[model samples]
Target: MDTANTMIRYVSPINPASFPSLSILLLAIGIFFMSWFIVYEVTSNRFTRNLKKELLVSFFASLFLGFGVLFLVLWVGLYV
Candidate 1:
């Protein structure tokens, strides 16, 4: 019973101001993994080579795309 109480008490709520950074980090990481997975799966085609290049491209693409959308939303939120 005491152990269960301590486990439940260990959780804490997140701060609202911290949300933007946390959200961006999580979104970017998720996008990176998802893009990598897609690229890997598509590479199964016999005609396709250069797996490293494909993975690198996907990584940077997702990174930029995630940050781009994040800034876009922040900019829009400022005006509206």
Candidate 2:
């Protein structure tokens, strides 16, 4: 019995089959809607020279921010 080989065998904490598919979907949708709504509301009152460009930027910014936060939380969760 090789101790090195035995210790190197991998085990995953996350199993896809056990994950809640609906929650993932809801999370994605919620993020999209929340981001969109906030962007729309913020920009709706202001007169933008390029409305389309403004909205697009806002959407992506919010999306990346949300994903960044989610990633950090998930990373922490895995360790703690």
All candidates' TM-scores?
A: 0.42, 0.38
Model 1: what TM-score? Answer: 0.42
For residues 1-80, write the lDDT of model 1, one tens digit per residue.
Answer: 66766674443355446546765775677677667767677766756657686677667767766765655465445521
User: Residue 48 in candidate 1 has what lDDT?
Assistant: 67
- Cα RMSD (Å) per model? 9.8, 8.8
User: Best candidate, lDDT-wise?
Assistant: 1
Mark the 10 consecutive residues where model 2 has the least summed lDDT.
Answer: 15-24
Clashing pairs in 1: none
Cα misplacement distance, residue 43 of candidate 2 (Å)? 15
Query: For model 2, what is the error of residue 24's alpha carbon versus the real structure, in angstroms, after optimal superposition?
Result: 21
